[model samples]
Target: MAICIPPLDASTESSAERKLHEALRSGLSDDFLVLHSVKWIAKPRGAGPRDGEVDFLICHPKHGLLVVEVKGGGVILDYAMRRFASIDRHGDEHEITNPFEQAMRGKFAILEKLKESPFWQKLGLGRIPLGHAAFFPDVDGVGGLVGPDAPLDIIGGRQDIALISQWVDRAFTYWAGPGGQGALSELGAGGVATVQRILARVSTTRPLVSARLVQEEQTRIELTERQAAILDLLSRQRRVMVAGGAGTGKTLIAREKAARAAEEGLKTLLVCYNRGLADHLREQCEGIEGLDVATFHQLCKRWIDKAKSELGRDLMAEARRDYPGGTEFDHHQPIALAFAIDAFGPNYDAIIVDEAQDFGDEFWLPIEMMLSDHADGLLYVFLDENQNIYGRSAAIPIKGEPMLLDKNCRNTTTIHAAAYRYYRGVRIEAPEITGTKIELLTAPDIDRQARAISALVTRLVAVEGVAPHDIGVLLCDGRARSSFERALAAMTIPKSSRWGHLEGYGQGSITVDSVAKFKGLERAIIILWGLDASDPVVDRETLYVGMSRAKSMLYLCGTVAACGRVLDAGVA
Candidate 1:
């Protein structure tokens, strides 16, 4: 088979080594699979190389496995000590680990890895033939070769790549065992298939560096000219309402303005409707002095606590009366806002609110109470009415006319087209950008939906090469969280929840959250799981928020009936 080299960055590799690698890639027959920079996690121990990085692992159907260690520069072999060194251009000798020993440890690590993977054991591939080789591309292989015991047959220069290939074939010609089973010659068709399967499983490849993803993240956070102009005007104008549809950079603008306010030595309080969105904003604005980030309820709770002593009224009792048997602090937001308007207020130089659509009329009175006395002190509001999932469509009580941010800087054109259907009344702009089309997956039940989600996650990670954090699996409501969790567990795909503080969640782990919880947050790839079309109005609003959360890729997963309703709602 044609040689297949895994993704690698040639910048860190030596010129000679790169040249040799290219030659091998071109020269090897279709039977060989050459993988570079393969990684395997091994338990930490005092022994050799602790099973981390392997330079190269070559697998062939007929030849079995070969672990090759490539070295650059003039390789010097010590005849007496039997050690290895490389001489630099200035004639400096740098002692190096023996390539043969390094390759042998890597071989052992691979064996250990295979032992741990139950998938490999099920394949029935027994004893796998293993070989080791040290490649020195700068060393002369054609003439003046090292004497016997020098491993000249395996240790060769660029000229002997074909010779090395021949040596590999010869090495495995007489080798016995399938892996842990009988001899290679005694293996049947099934056993041979098992060998192929095992080889494929052990081969893992990722680029040494992903410059494209880095650049994409940078560009995403950077503001466009129009957005900058609006931000500039809003920053200077002080008190104004900013209106925009999903992906219009409303959240980002709010954040920038808040950051600027804090930088100007003004005490700022940045608030949002959703607790999750508040937490996200807090994380983004971390380390900015003179800034306090909190949810609307959180802000209300602070004032409510103070109002107890000043108002001479039991605010908790009043809140319970307003929302009977409610345990959450949000249930008291209206009562607290009313209390603040009547009895308590703390002046903040700047108060910025995001996800303003989720707030009710009572919220604005308290916001007004906290406004600073100075003219430059700002109170900015950002809203996208279509995203108001709670059906609270109250107008933001701001003095000046709302500045409209029409251009969307987040989602790609394809994604925007799919999301814009639900936002019909808004002037959603679509730039000439290309991206994956919105995908709608229909399943019979939760089980099938889980399977579909699992498969999609694998494809996005392995095929499209998207990072796990960039991918989010969002549920329509918290009740569906268990079903998605069950699906993920059934598929054996480990994922982190976005519900709590998530202290120990690794950045590379896939995130699971409700669509409502993920409002004001953006991911590169989003899978909206367990959409309920029973209430078309509610479902439409929820899906509108979830669909726009994906910056580039969007996957809608639900039952056939639910999907039909979504399609009827004009969102695909």
Candidate 2:
């Protein structure tokens, strides 16, 4: 048996360790770099512990600072004193992995690999002053990496944890160089370049994702600088959260993220608010291989169904029975149930949530429950608090920071800027496609609105080259069906009706759809007809979501006043 194990609370200590790292980053005269949460699976053939991820690797210039394993986790492990260390590894397999030892071996391997890399000297982030430590920040007064009777420091007035940390800092100071000055600039030039090359190779050969946008008629649809930056940020972070206004491409980013996960050999789930978006996502992700996208409720229902099927009960009956009706519920209840049961049912390696602000408190509880303690799954969230009409989500749920996606990609920057003018507080993210313009039309009634919309759709597809499938129309409630169909019939545009179905729209089914049901998909030319300026909810925002759907052109068909409202809303 080992006399003492490494610190077991590395992750918990991450907060404090992070503070120290940030301090080092700010105070260090030279780079004593800490590589965060780098997974180091045992190479195909190697010595030492074969599989695990490294929390941090301290890179000094000359002498190697150790690769440290941080454990935010507290509580000591005394295996010799106790026999209750049995760990369930699933499927009847039982094993015990001491976190300390695990961390130690990981440190050794990372240091060894860094020492042997080709770019160790050229790119500048060299591996000379390298060392490793397992920090437990929560144990403020704690010292050493052991437990209660095992002789570990506990947080208290008597504990000398700060002194111990200072000692560790001094102990590992040699990693920053002979005198610990950490001037390995020459070394970094080479090491940084080499690490980049190596990572590039690994990514090319065995990537964490394989991604591409599925666009047949969106040649003009270009990703803005902000969109590209968001993608870049997504590439670096293990957990990414995107918060943007409506028509800000949150769902699109979520889809793109799914594609990236698939490219990286990870299974991904694209979760949305309702079946409309869910079904739309399902259809869109059809050609993207290895992507397992679905609605959260749908996926949860599937899980509950699978679990319940084994117990011999009708899953649908049970799920719907809770509502005493069908489909819609208190909204929070289904979400709560999904979050609860599937908390441990991640079922996949990566997850992306869209319309996140619509989710409730207990929603994430299920996700947390489903995650394995040491699992390397990536969690990404996409949401916009401004779009949260229901007051459901909180900023930074699960402690994730929001990455602002202010560039609007769905509309011409001009039209997107318009919504911001109406709701001036909103920040509009610009699109890469610059020439597209917003057109507003004044109509006496539905007849004129339909005529204007039909004319706009025809011009966009025929004159501008936008695909028929990429053009869509959003009609406000009442007489919209007859108005849209009559206009389209006059033009001989073939259409289908989703009139009664729960998710009532399709790719090429028809030109006109309800604003609520057309949540997940997008088109190049979007016409919103019959927008009622009088309705409280159908104001700037209601149309904002509708207008942002068009990639090239937007046509608003409404009363003269409503038309003016739309036109004024477009000019931010």
Candidate 3:
């Protein structure tokens, strides 16, 4: 089987080109390298500048190079007027350049481009055989269609499709005389690979993170508009729960609900469990009047501070003394907020919660109490059970069945496939965008992993144009987080590099956080590090949250055995 650049099924509007491409791909031997639709611009010496496309360029070690110009449909040649036309299936005739002339021009243009490369001269490739041909797949026979330039041997018809190899050999022999050039035979596989490298140089520029974010935002807007009907259907209901898998725009819908309530002149509070998510929600609702955004803990702190005098005691001191250091925030905050709200009365006309799955069973009471009218005020909750990393089985207190959002508007198809392995709920239709594959970087230990991550971040920021703030380093194990931080700090930082934790996010630095803490938040690029084959905490739920946090690019870095375990687990 011949190797075809762009493949035979690649998108093309020309049916004739596709037909000839298929013939060349299927009929040629494995030694042949066929490039279809090669665009070039050249200004040969003693000739006007030529800029056009070559329908097909075939290269072989034994036969040298051949440029083929293919014309589909009915071919009409006007010898007297020196004009050419092709009639389509609709019987509409369109004048076109002579295929023979086009083939010759393309052949020379490519030759000229190749000669400009020093490697071409180093290999003495100029002495190799070169030829051109015109193929008309719709024409039955072109044996009698001879002209000064369009010789019978140089023109191919539909009948030649089956004997394409023979036809190509004949054309090469015609250009090389009775005996082929010995130089052609000497251009072996290595020479062919070098030629391909010269013709199609390895060059690429990744889309800037800012630009990609804009494109993704636009797609979300379109998908979100499609979900507007769901919101409209439940507009009259005062209390509703929206359930969805990750990337299903649950947070987007929650934001919209809060904004709508504010638009209606009702004071609204948009709250979530994660501080990162709360910060994001606040940014999204910045200018809206009558709307307030805060993390559940932040909301608790606010009310607790306001009701301190009525309680007649330092609640923070009491909680610190009664509970363990970190337990005080989880155990005493919500209870204190409830008492504060009861004394101060309800603070808002409507309340909205996002990432509701992260809240404890008792957390709902204080959330509901914030509404001015507990029975009639709007209370909207958005939750994804699969993302419940906190191990909370708390269900929303809403009475009716939750509305389901099954279409994922965020994350590329590749990311979705990897993340959905651990998902066990209603099916989520993958996003339409088929992004690049997830990259897995394996290292021997934490130090090497940190170095690899640093190198990757450098390339992404300095070479690929990705913004530092748009990239995140999410640690899978809590213990590895400090090791990575120490490794990064001890290294000689690049002049352009800046690293920070979630606290310094958006401060023009690459943010780092634990996967559990970074839940409900996303970044354009995520580097999930510190997976251990022996670590029990690196389970399905943890992997799902860490991998899905990447909106575009994902890199999994860990020990070889650990990375192997993830792949063996079928998360790829």
Candidate 4:
């Protein structure tokens, strides 16, 4: 049977009350009493003129029950007044609710219901006391809801509310669980009702992190005139394609742009086609804050799933405005895009597709679709056609449309110069470091190269002070298993995986495989052990990708003749 709870805050309510209600929805306290109170005393949403519903309910097992409510003026903010939330229709204007009195009325309604409810007597619910509270402030342009009795004035702000939450949690500990459930149920019931009534009037503003968190330190890397010009316009363009060769700083430039965006009060998203490049970014962006970095594929999965849950779309459709595009965002709008996202679910605020060169062809469509829908969202991208180790023929996602960051920051000047001479048509600017002599090494047979590589790595890590983790070997035919076997037999290396993928963190490595697999990845030293010169360009590309992986060193021990020919023009 339905229980009747009076509409307690009936006196004065409007749309201004939404923020408070929404904030309390999903996280209705973990305490058993708190949870019960919230669920049982929930105010009938949309039953009146208020624009929103209560945040959440907290039914206690004992003590006066708490009806949790949130409140703020039109806005909530950081110390310098960077608005996190506003209480009104726009960022301006305060709501019109007296939170305190409204809370009392809510308490009364719950009491009324408790007295009449057969469920109350059957369950012994009426003995519970009642209490109510309103909380969470509004920031500029952000909002919150309030009961008619809410405190319209701003207090200590967001920090105060955080403290208040602690107090509330502690005070209600008596009703947290099994031992406390029964007593709390009777005592806190009324308090929960009042809070619900007021809470029902609140709404959730945007999260604070997205709006406020920022970094203070900044640094600079000199840019060429062309680089400066392209980057300048790139700062403003949302969707851009950046393509170039070895020293282009395509990666470096992208990082700077993302950092700059964060500084401009916009979120920064950095992505790469390869795990290696992504790792390199993590290493490079170590100190800079506010950059949300990830691989293109990973982000696509996240946004689509998040959006789907929010919209509740169990079925698929074409271009559902709501569905977020996931993993395969190959450019151009496609019917397939809708189906894909319909399954995964939501879109993100912005997107940055890195390493566009290596992503399989025909993947830009969904990306275009998602980036088109969001506000102030980015569609930033970076890549180098010459660096397409995957051999996919997908047209670069952006034409004149992309912003290029193709400056090589990882290589020395000699390496950069050599890359340019050896690899023509590649659009990378050489690093300014003086050249390091390129050498070729080969054994009487395959055995010789392997031993040299293994020894080189051991020496670098043990004597050179590089972490064993910082050295990697690139071998043909997926020789990681072979290496593991030898290492296990010889007891030279331990059998282990990087980052605990077995525990479900990531797909990590224990050995050598295709250079493509390690694209975007880096180690302090790279040892390219096996080589076949059958396809010079292909081998050159693989060598390029591998060489670029090291921040400090590259140890290549392959067919001397083949190596020399590949490096004949120059060394990358």
Candidate 5:
């Protein structure tokens, strides 16, 4: 049986085309390759450019090339008017293009396109035989439909379906003419493979990193506009808590709200739990005056330092004296910030907290106290409970019901499918952007995994034309991140490659970091490494956060057993 490019399916609109496709697939030898619905645009030497489509482009090592046009229903040809039509089962006639002309034009156009390839000249395939034919599965006899261009031998009818190979061979012979057998034989198996490669290269294409990013940004803007309605609805509310899953634009909405508040002459502070996210917010909100961005601990430390410098009060020392048991940042910093807020009084008119689920109950008091008027000051908190990897259970101080963001606008549908398996939350509507599937690359150990990753990175950058900075390598096992980094550093990478953390992401280097550090952030392409099923730290939440970071493409690299465990964990 012949191989089909797209594989014959019921989705084909024309019943006649489907019938012909099946007949060719079953009747042709294994050497033949049938490509259906092949469309192309061509510019002949003296004529203007024209668009053409061949219903079936048949290729064989021994038979050369043939373009076949299939007309399922009754075909009507008017030689005087040079017009053609098709009669349906209901006896209704629909005007149609001349199948013979279309097939011939498609054949020439495809031949011209193939000739443009340097490979054709190198292989000396210019003299290879090429032909065109028309097939009418519903018509009883097309032998009388011969003309100057439509020869009787090149026109097929219902009875010819059983002997499609012989009919095609006859068409080839008619086009090749006498003594053209040498030309047909010239396109040996090797030459035919070269032609296939040329055709495939010309036909297959993918968007580059820049174009994909632009498309994704446009989609994000549209989705953000849809989420803006929620802000408009809550414009008058003093305190609001917005809850959503990852990629729901919580951080984006928070930034917009903070900017608007600052524009109103209100001092606004935008804070999140992740330092990388905080740095990103700071960079994005740089020129906006009266708005400050920081992580919760960073804000606490900044306030304590200011109090000690200007007010002659060492709040950090006092907090250390009072709370001496737990970690300084966790226990003492919030206390110090509360003391500093008391000393300086409310300094901001509004405060926006992103990644609110990462903040503990103790952190909200000082946060609320930062508002000039606690009763009427604006406080918006965005949180996704599922991403509380640090396991903080804070009862947010917002009064009214939290608004729910159900749509995910960040990750593509393919990445969403893998990530949402571990998500335990309200249903999140997947994004409309359907992207490439998650690729799994397995090795036996970290050394082999590093080599595979290096090759993949090179291909993505050198061959696939992806920017180095657009790619990221995230370690699923945070503890093994350094080990993976060392292994990768030992490998021979491209000279253009620069390895750094998420802080240096998109700055002309490929960044590598733990999935936890990259929380609340995303990259266009993500390569997740060090996925060990035996590691206790690599749990469902870790997988969810790591896999969700990819916006366009995702490659999961690990040992076979590790990858198998991940797939078995419902991520398949």
Candidate 6:
């Protein structure tokens, strides 16, 4: 684990030292312990200038201890006089502090500190070996230092950096002897352990996080730096509304804020309009305590279930009798809301609603009433009015101006440009493209569309190298799910694939979800099917939702008329 002692003095570090620090950090393994820009106290308190700074003190189990002093400017070495001088960019030479001498002083100070430290003093290190070197990152050459008097072995430029491990090995052999036949042979393994304990006195600047953990974190949907900053700002407010275009990471920010609230011991509820999105959030927040994830209807159901015992009436039974089995809950939401409010009031510390644009003004009232009375009670809503395919045009029920997130980090520039042109009236910041242009495919009928989509998926897997889970096939019309399934069956794709009607696939399975279901989620590549511009207004929003789901690549498949609506701004 890397460590820092007494923090860093930025003013004291030359440009060369900074560059060398970054180089060593990137080159070295995590197993090595490093302390950089450190102040080593030479003596007991007030005994002259005690603070002696060193550029870096690196420690490893096999390499023992290494101290490095960095110099940035050009250097002139006099072999006869054994003097070192610094040369500036203007070719003027100036006498500078000898790096070797500085390293030695810092080394002495470090040893003294180790001996004085109670933790290290107990180790009882006896004559532990240490290596010191001078690094010149800016200097390309050293002149006048030749023959036996030259300290070529101790001084190094950039070219010599690759041989540092060999140098450390030589130092270990010289001071401790080769193999088990070293100077500390009598002390054995115990003495080496003590020396390591001495060098480990420096404090770590940050906790050790594994590379795998970092990689996993990177794989998860991430917010841009600006979006993260806005999230931070929202945390400080009592109520907030965030509005962003597709791929702007609004849902990611909502989940993050909900997770943070749970971490802070708040009773948090994360709600979204899409059932698939709610399930996704629930899975993402699996182990988080005091955090509940559910769709708006699911949340209302829970409240209704609670009211059954208190009101001494089966509210769900009444709803079922009225709305019947296959009825959508959007029309019954107000009834559920009334029942929920009468049953429970203000039980949660924070309420975060995602896909808020899909909710009517009244849908938020019961949710707002669920917040606790504390001043810090939070009600954060994230939305994108442009993607409001559900036709909820009422004003949102919340206070304060919504913070706008214009950056689209999810899609490549090409796909985002197409989506922007489709919705030209809305404000959308152009995204930085790092992938291929969107592929618009035409098929005369559903049969040909299916074949084309299957081929695209095949090429994406074989040629583009995208993983199965990273790919998605979106169908807007529910009726097209079976046709695509039959076409995919004809292609004999793996049985591991999942349709939206089935249970959760979790990960590692290609998903086929409707555009409405796939909202608030994204994939590396997308194959959009079943968009027909016969109803241009409906098809535009649906097609927009499908195309925006692709982060890197988008393969659009439909009749020529449907694909044309996507290219032209035909939907209002």
Q: Quote each prediction's TM-score.
A: 0.56, 0.56, 0.59, 0.49, 0.61, 0.59
State each model's CA lDDT, in order.
0.66, 0.53, 0.75, 0.48, 0.78, 0.66
Model 5 stretches astray by more than 4 angstroms: 1-220, 224-226, 534-538
Candidate 4 per-residue C-alpha lDDT over 197-312 given as tens digits, one digit per residue, 9 for 90 to 100:
33221221111000011121122346665666566566445567776765455655676666544433334567666654565565555665456776666655555455467655
Q: Give lDDT: candidate 4, residue 422.
A: 41
Instruction: Write model 1 residue lDDT over 1-572, tens digit each, in one string.
Output: 34555443545456655755665677678666677665533322232112245677767665666677777777666656877788777888899877667777887876665554444455666666676666767766523435353344445566676565665554454343335325543333443344344333222111111112232354434566567667646633557888888877787778777876665446788998776667666766789878899988887777777777776677777877877865544446666566665664456767899889888765776776776543444688888888888778565767766888888777888777766777745576775568877788888887888788877777767777776767777787667577668667777443432222122224565668777777777777888877754445646677777778888788878877776676566643
- On lDDT, the stronger of 4 and 5 is 5
Query: How big is the RMSD of model 5?
Result: 20.7
Per-residue lDDT over 208-283 for candidate 2, one digit per residue giving the tens place of the 0 to 100 score? 0101123433243345557666765665555678778656667766777777665444556677775667766676
- Model 5: lowest-lDDT 10 consecutive positions: 203-212
Query: Looking at model 3, which ten-residue stretch has the lowest summed lDDT?
Result: 203-212
Q: State the lDDT at 427 in candidate 4.
A: 61
Model 5 lDDT per residue over 96-119, tens place: 989899888888888876664445
Per-residue lDDT, model 3, residue 280, is 66
For TM-score, candidate 3 versus 4, the one ahead is 3
Query: Of the candidates shown, which would achieve the greatest TM-score relative to the real structure?
Result: 5
User: What are the runs in model 6 whose C-alpha is more than 4 Å off?
Assistant: 1-222, 309-311, 316-328, 331-333, 374-376, 424-426, 462-465, 494-502, 506-508, 534-538, 568-572
Best by lDDT: 5
Q: How many clashing pairs per prediction, in order?
A: 12, 69, 0, 111, 0, 2
Q: Could you arrange the candidates by TM-score from highest to lowest?
A: 5, 3, 6, 2, 1, 4
Against the correct fold, how does model 4 do in TM-score? 0.49
Q: For model 6, what is the alpha-carbon lDDT of residue 213?
A: 20
> Model 3: clashing residue pairs?
none
